[model samples]
Target: MRQHGLEAAISRRRFLALAGALGGAAALGGCGGDGGASSSKVTYWVPPNAELSRMQAYLADVKTGFQKAHSGTTLDNVVVPWEDALTKYTAAFSGGNPPDVTYQIIPWMNKWRSTGVLADFRTLDKGFTDTFLNGVNPDYVKAAEGPKGELLGLPYVGGYWVLALNEALWEKAGKPTLPKTYDDLIPFAQAMTFDKNGRKLGESGYDARNVETYGMCWAPSPPIQENYLWHYFWSFGSDYISADGMDVGFKDDAGRAALRHMKAMVDSGAVTPPNLYSDDVRWQAAVMSGKAAMAWSEGFTAEYAKQYPQLRIKVLEPPAGPGGQYIVGACGFLSVAAKARNRSGALDLVKYLVDDKPLQDFNKLILAKPVRQQPSNYYDGLDDPRMTTFMNEAAALSKYVKITRILPYQPQEYLVGKINDFLLGRQSMDAMIDEASKQIKQMAKAAK
Candidate 1:
């Protein structure tokens, strides 16, 4: 397996450092004014990296309505890159002039608390945390909790992963049915995999050298990469770590069996060889051009599929790996900086953003829906059926949020990339498993 390039890791750390270094910038920018006046102007930092455009629109609509209702205060929103959010956030704390509100993933709450960068919401509004979607998922909440068990971030959105199927390929393979259980999936994948000569199903004259369409196109990367492994690990009734993420769980037999099963997908040619960074364009080209059969993608992808009208696509829950278990992942939340200037305004923004009106607008504009209490009023005439489909699947499965651990910063990504390398013939499966287990243990030890 290839080691994560030094530059890749350094770039990430440097980004965080820069964010922390912003204390002087805020001071120089004159942003350290004493909490704005009796009526304050609050600054909120939204990650400016990729979602800048999407967040900009959401903030605009939210600010217009919020300012109209709350005459006492105003909102000043800034888009910070996810890469720079940590550093910039800490920098805000350095000058004691932090933005009134900020966005963050829940798991980092504990990490930030250790740095004394986060403020306790419990100290400000006792009922504020409870007003939001606290139980969206326990794992998610745990990710957002401080080491002291205080809530650090609020649940802003909910989504899950799904199998993206190219129906054209399915129909070509004699209308093969979508497998629901692990037992049904292997054979189905084998059937979907074929040679260019159209020789399939172990029939006569099968040509090994002329493999045509792949049964699956799976990547070993972040966001969606390790998803396959998690299903396998859990279906076999195993976990990556213990409840608190304090111990490694993959050292056991169930984990080994799960790893073996996943590796078989590559050995048997059921899925593509490991390509850590499988670009979206490559996936679209392969799936649309009929070179690949299926892809594992999130809910937002279905909406993007509309651009290719000629391709007949479908979405289904990923096949159960060992048991009839399915896991779903989602993203959404609005956080108030602990050192925020306009505490009242921050809380109000959280209320309105997660509330019905703006949440609905966000769902429309971004093409990604949220799990708010009230459904959006904007979808009455939206011609997109993908939204309803994604919502139905999300509603059916219980969302499982990622666990946030301090030491192995990007644990899931590391696990997936390493194991995937073995599956692609880059290393022995046993070696990969052992190495990953060791790394995870060291990470846990460091966290302690």
Candidate 2:
């Protein structure tokens, strides 16, 4: 899932509302159609994609392939808008009419699991579990597991957030070397930043207010803040919360250092102001339109190139820090509902969807990497060299990346909002840290 897309659809308010409904939903029973092993039908629910027509065509192909593979079986495909998905799923479960299988992100796992509607794939089919485990990445498998290590979901697609540079801008700046460390990035960005009069940053008569091109851009708003910003924290050796999930983890030296470095970038006047371009589209536009020379992006260079053919974009390795090189990744999963009427048929459909052909096709459609092992057609099918480079870099960096966890509370809004306030000079660094820490602790306590 794209960082902005996921964040926009599931706001803090909506998540809290879903959390409230999950409590009562736990006591509700299933009410959908009953289809035993001999049943001829299985219902599936998927979130809508930005490429609606293409996704519809892909789904149609999937239906044909699935029905052909399983004679006498029918696939009931349904598209659910992400904005209303949580409520719809909750209602479906409460009314006992939930789909047999549905698409889910890592964050929603705990909430739906709490509602007692997700099936434990481990118990449903050991053969399928063993096959899936042997074929898919272990990290994705781990992300799909429940607290007790049960297979609550089957991960299929994944992506990472990395640094993307405007090659033309770098070429114009005398082809300065790419930054390998966090400390190196500021100067690298400043070299590319210029004023309306062509005065480079740090040069005489340069004006920050009249910046014609920014050195870098990053999203610090809700929905994508946690997704994109936390890499800096991880690189600085800080986490938002303790591993046990009981206390604040960012109220430390590393966390403070990370915040200071972020502020320094803003203070350098080489970064696009957070208020000016707060969302993903605007963030990409900053780079595409030559307003910014580089950006923290989720491997969207290929798509950006299509829109602006003249601009040369290059995917770069994530910057390293005292903590080491690190990036954040997220995966999408296909999960079966516990109350599925055709439990056996549902399992079959899940396994079928993960098979090589369908899985690779789905990943290609979304421009995501398949969760399965590589050396397959998926990699060979990538037409863009930049996309291939991105895939290769992502695979090499997978060892340093961590899949986002299933947290008890949504922590993006509180943490990112305070950081933005500090960057914008509305609050002191100390105040931002203290206030954010307090809110996080309260959220954890309340979740219990």
Candidate 3:
């Protein structure tokens, strides 16, 4: 959490005093329409990403609509970077002050709750919690719940790693078919690999890589594979943790097979060598510039493509693996600091932000699939065939992705990068896994 210099001005005592004096706040079961974000003025902190910028643009309409329907409320927004979110959030709480409501990645919900930074959302109105999607993957829900099964966050987005195609490039490469299974991808990639000079697919093209373009790129660099690789790991029916989270899963045959497959991709030169800092921006540049042909990317790619008018892109299910189809992530939500300046107002803000309408609107702008399947007015213009295809795939195929509890100890991106290096022969799998397992056991012991 990164804090702004201004946060220091609001002391904890002053903040609690402010909340206590806000007399209109209601008890737990009652809705506080005029007190929450519905208050005359309320603040919201969101990630300062392109996704949020797009939302920021439409916030006026959203504020106006809500204010019009109610009376005097206004929605005030703050933008925070993903890397600095934790520090900022902590600073806010230390002073008994924080935004009325704010979003955090799912994994951190439990972490925050343990520190008593989050409110017990179960105390909210009965049907409020009931409105989320049914049959949501249990593992995904478990990730958001704190100790003793307290639900700390509500998933508004169901993020999954997916295959994206540059149709023009694919057709130029001879309209190769989509891969149905992990093994099938090897040949599909072979067909897609081409060079203006007609050299070996990945390496033979040119020192400058005169190949028409790369077939694909897997990010999270050399010594640590990215979390995205988990989808493939799971496709082999392997997990990073045992069911009880008591032991590492890497020594299992299935886990080794998955690692071997990823290693093979690196060895075969089918993917980009890892770049420690090549985040989504680097990924966008590679695909948008036609330097790379395909990617297993986040759903936001479609949303990003809207900025490039000439680029025609399409989304598809990630190729199935030995275990059938697989996906590796779910959505995340917000948690208010328990010691906020306007505690009641903060809870109200949470309810307001997650109200069906805002979530639907946010999902629409980001081209996200809903965690809840119930339809909303937000989907009105999304009936186009292309949109339908992607949406349907998201609904039926994506699965919740989870990993060993050592997540906090092992920077997720670093872990994936390390694994990639091991597979590339830069390091041995046993040696790498041994190091990772050491970290995992330490975390597991601490968790105990």
Candidate 4:
């Protein structure tokens, strides 16, 4: 809804103009000197993490191993917060000082490529390109492509949403058989929801306002909402945009049904109120504190379990909708800056990071699936069977996975915010759908 920061406040046109001006200035300044392809130093940027110590150790290992392998090269590792990464990257590029390589999301890759700030790895080392193309998942490759099919980035990790249940709460609710369909999930959720007085939904004298625990908890903000809602849209035979990318795809009966189902869950008082817990951390805290019985785990249950071993969390396939069972999947990518000083060194670092051993360790630490087809079996050794279950389910559901397209103008935050407004009863379902459709068409047409 409301624009968040400097990044969101700047209009696209104004931002581009500023970037072009600064870029030109940097170009006239000799592009910060030619470090050349075989330069001995490379700078890298990664997103911020809650487990600072663990992530620092991982980065240290990467730096040590890379320096050892390259023999005389230095690696400058930097941790950038996701909220500030886009802005920082833009400033860095404009100043001719961007990191040689950075971890980015598909949307960022698309955004930077449009601004000529991202490099096409296809134009880099052939050996690395060949290895990446032949080894990584085709779905991810597709997700990371530029408008003209250029390799904007290399996929590093992938994940999908799953149903995460609190085992203790499940047992308290009589351990009812897990829901297999959206229709079946309602009653199960009702069973898990209760008031301070111990009255569950549908029972006489139950007070929804005084509820102590909810059946489900999930953040309804921006990116998280978009990611979580896509699973429902796909399962209901709807999608965010049409295959041709010319229009909104979910404007029909399937879309309406999906929205209605979501609204019903909220109206049933079984889902955490979006207005109350608008933050992701608070939503996760609800599940962690045992105040919520279930949640839509966005591929983080393993990390959560590792952090909180006392809570028994179980991962289950998302409840199927009438159309089919599906999962909304996405990938994180590694991209080189277009003005990177050491292109060859950047490619080398990307290669080293995605190699089997390092990739396995990274994915294990984050509990993510590798971009490569031959995934590591480190999950098999986890003390929690749920981690193994998540991995196996992700692999099994690969066929049913739907990856969101990287659009020139990503309106995901606005679109999902409108959906939340509708969910919170601020607007009618028809108004929400119609307005969203109009917004998508207008943005898409403008981008074209």
Q: What C-alpha RMSD separates each model from the true structure?
A: 5.7, 5.4, 8.7, 6.7
**Model 3 lDDT per residue over 1-448, tens place:** 1011111111112223333443333122112122232335556676532334365575666566655755555566665554455676666655455666667665455457566666656755446665553555665566667776777666545555457677777787778778777777776666566666745474433433455566776655321124356666678887766656655676788888988887776655556655523554565456556666677644434534465556756666667777656555545566654544445555566666567777666666655555544433335556354454445555444453432242333334445655756866777989888887776677667866
Sort by TM-score, best first: what order?
Answer: 2, 1, 4, 3
Error of 3 at 403 (Å): 7.2
Model 3 TM-score, all chains together = 0.75
* Full-model lDDT for every candidate: 0.58, 0.71, 0.56, 0.70
Candidate 4, residues 230-280, lDDT tens digits: the string is 767778888767777767777888988888888888787788777766556
- In model 2, the Cα lDDT at residue 33 comes to 44
Name the 10 consecutive residues with the lowest summed lDDT in model 4: 1-10
Using TM-score as the yardstick, the better of models 2 and 3 is: 2
* Model 3: CA > 4 A from native: 1-43, 49-54, 72-77, 80-84, 133-137, 198-210, 220-227, 243-247, 273-280, 299-308, 336-352, 374-408, 443-448
Model 2 alpha-carbon drift over 4 Å, by segment: 1-38, 134-139, 278-280, 301-306, 372-397
Q: In candidate 1, which residue ranges exceed 4 Å CA deviation? A: 1-38, 48-54, 106-110, 220-224, 242-247, 275-289, 299-307, 321-324, 328-330, 369-408, 425-429
Residue 161 shift from truth in candidate 2, angstroms: 2.6
Best by TM-score: 2
Give the Å shift of residue 431 in candidate 2: 2.1
Q: Write the per-residue lDDT of candidate 1 for residues 74-96, one digit (tens) a residue.
A: 77767665554557666676777
Which of candidates 2 and 3 is the stronger one according to lDDT?
Answer: 2
Which prediction has the highest lDDT against the true structure? 2
Candidate with more favorable, higher lDDT: 3 or 4: 4
